[model samples]
Target: MAFDYDQYIRGGKLPHIWCPGCTYGIVFKSILRVVDTLKLNRDDIAMVSGIGCASRLPGYVDFNTLHTTHGRALPFATGIKLSKPDKHVLVVSGDGDATAIGGNHFIHACRRNIDITMLVFNNFIYGMTGGQHSPTTPSGHLASTMPYGNVDPSFNIPELAKGAGASFVARGTAYHAAGLDKLISGAVQHKGFSVVEIINACPTTHGRRNKFKSPTDMLLWMKDTFLPAVAFDKLPAEKTAGKFPMGVLFKKEGAPEYCETYYGLVERLKKQREGRA
Candidate 1:
């Protein structure tokens, strides 16, 4: 017997938009693992997404979902978290959508420390609306927007989240299937803002443009580049150049959730209106 994803899968859309060997499907499976491990009710969870290849994830999963404007997933998910306060909200988005176009919301979402889980699929290039130079697109990386090679440095997403007041932050590459499942599960279980940035491979645009002839080659590149916790601590300054590591970059407690603050304001207003009346 085989594990039939049809149990939770939203059928009738027989074909998916993702290219063959694209890593988004793999990431989706990991998310499903988290959803399954928690044994959560589909009615209690909301999967929100913005306009991108990754954004299409919500359409395939059986849950309360929203397909919002580009770069607005964080705010929309924030609204869901603040209003419902008890629902499990997750945002599935791409690097550009999460970090570039939605960078403002991303920053404030972390500052708010809302009880929502954000999974950023970082393939380095903007694959959905064409291969553009996204905020996380590495320095010297080639893209449609940066044909000559990108000059700006890339963002360290998990580290940025930690600095911006996110309660939990973790990095997981597409190659680390089981590792991602564990990290995502832990993040969803956490009570405050959590970000799981998955470094994935874009076989169509990034792969073809970057000159990788096959999918496995891109996976090898990821394997060669990724480092686990404390793996880069011993590396000297120059040796660490252009290197990117992935893992539970940082996490801590004591940050107040945004819903708690919102409810406090609501109660305060109610008492104020009563006194005036």
Candidate 2:
């Protein structure tokens, strides 16, 4: 029997507004599957997002959701996590929203190792803002702002998250739907900061400009380019240079969670004050 997806989505928000061929829907479904498999209570989950195409997800999902300012999703989610450490907080953001505008927040969140799961929809271009060149747009890619071809280098999101001290780091693509669900589940279960970057295609913008005749072509590219970590590890450097490896990339245990540490410090300060009095 097929699972009822409507249980998680808002009844009034049927027929989402994403463009045809956009793979954000696939990633969203993966998230729902993870939620179902984990059996997490909807009331205990808080979904937050910054302004962008991907940011609209929280509005459509039935949960405690926050649509925050551009580049500020992480900080807002941080406050939520700090206040109610028992609640699970999730952030959904696009490449531009996460890496370009919210870059500082993203890194800092990782540094603190706060318990929040962030899923970045990396479609290479800024799909919401007229397909401009985003921080993750590949070099030589075409965008509305870079009609002549993108000259700026793109960011390797997984590496950045690991460097910033994220306890869990993983990569998934929309084409690999099952893999995305697994990665998202792992990220959510982790006790510290976790980042899962899902590679998707902005068919309307990135595809047309890049000569991908259709959105399916872009997805096929993802299916071919991204490989399982074990298989990817066997390839030569030149052969694997541009390919993305799927599955968990990094995970560290025993790091003290930020909110727990903060609360402990508060308790210590209170005790000291009481002793002095």
Per-candidate Cα lDDT values, in order, are: 0.87, 0.93
Best by lDDT: 2
What is candidate 2's local distance difference test score? 0.93
RMSD to the native, candidate 1? 2.2
Which pairs clash in model 2? none
Q: Among these predicted structures, which one has the highest TM-score?
A: 2
Residue lDDT tens for model 1, 14-72:
47899887888889888987898899899999999998899998998889989999999
Give a tens-digit lDDT track for model 2, residues 227-277.
Answer: 998899999999998787888999998888899899999999999999999
TM-score to true structure, per model: 0.92, 0.96
Model 2 spans > 4 angstroms off: 270-277
- True-structure RMSD, every candidate: 2.2, 1.4
